[model samples]
Target: MTMMTLQDDLTTAAAKGNTADVESLLRRGAAVNGVNRFGRTAVQVMMMGSWPVAQALLQHGADPNVADRSTRTTPLHDAARTGFVDMVRLLVAAQADPQARDNQSRLPVDLARENGHAEVVAFLETLK
Candidate 1:
């Protein structure tokens, strides 16, 4: 397959939360930081509920701080927006910047609070 196709596949697998496929794609030399057709890295589109997928990407050197091309929101922003606290934790462990702002100039904690994720808001407050 073409390199672009391989990279897209990696992002697709990550988005699907198919950990095995993500791992296999990584093993096949998919660029851990490759952006898909949407110009988003796998970590950017990865399923919010799949910590294993996040872990695989992080271990493979996926940049935890990469902001979305349009929204300028990092993976942690997405996780916090979706109320996936575990995913937030995983990204933080991988050195995601909690203070990173999006196009709206709102932090991940702001998104978490806006989404009514009290636990996530609480967790992020401790990091400040």
Candidate 2:
């Protein structure tokens, strides 16, 4: 398959929480940070759940800070909003910016707080 197809497939796999497929695509040289037409990277989509898939992507060099073009929301934003504490931690370890502001100029901590993710809030506060 073409490199573009691999990338697009990787994005789809991530969205569906298919960790094995993600690993396969990566092994075959898919661009780890590849985004779709909307600039939605695999890392960002994987943030919805399936830490295993997210971890595989991250381990394979997916960028945790690549934001969506429309929302300017990074994987960190999604992780924080969803109260995925472990995902947030993993993203941070991958060098995601906790203070990154989206199109709405809101930080990850703000999202965590608004979403009632107290642990995420407390963790992000330390980064500021």
Candidate 3:
């Protein structure tokens, strides 16, 4: 298969929370940091609710801080926006930048608070 196809499969696997598929793709030399059609890497796609997939991607060298091309939204931003504490922890341990801004100059913490995620707000406050 083409390199682009492998990358697309990797992102799709992560998005679907299929860790086995993700690991398989990585073993086949898929680009861990490759952006899919949505301008998000595998780890960024996993940030929606799949910490295991995110971790798998990270272990395979997916860049935790990689941002969406249009919004500049990193995995941390997605995790915090949805109050996904485990995802936040995973990204933080992977060295994601909590202060990184998006296209709107909004940080992850801002997104959390805007969504009424108090626990996420407190956690991010400690990081700052």
- Best by the lDDT measure: 1
lDDT of 3 by residue, 1-128 (tens): 43557878888888789989999999998889877766667887773677788878888777888888778888899899989888888888889999899999999999999999898889889987
Ranking the candidates on TM-score from highest down gives 1, 3, 2
Tens digits of per-residue lDDT, candidate 2, 1-128, equal 43557767888899898888989989998888877654667887773668898889888887787887788998899999999898888889889998899999999999999999999999999887
Candidate 1 residue 122 Cα shift, in angstroms, is 0.9
Clash count, predicted structure 1? 0
Candidates' RMSD to native: 1.9, 2.6, 2.4
TM-score of 1: 0.95
- Sorted by lDDT, highest first, which candidate order results? 1, 2, 3
Deviating ranges (above 4 Å) for candidate 2: 1-4
Count of clashes, each model:
0, 0, 0
Q: Write the per-residue lDDT of candidate 1 for residues 39-124, one digit (tens) a residue.
A: 88899999999999999999999999999878899999999999999999989989999999999999999999999999889998
Alpha-carbon lDDT, every model = 0.93, 0.85, 0.84
The candidate maximizing TM-score is 1
The estimated TM-scores of all candidates read: 0.95, 0.89, 0.90
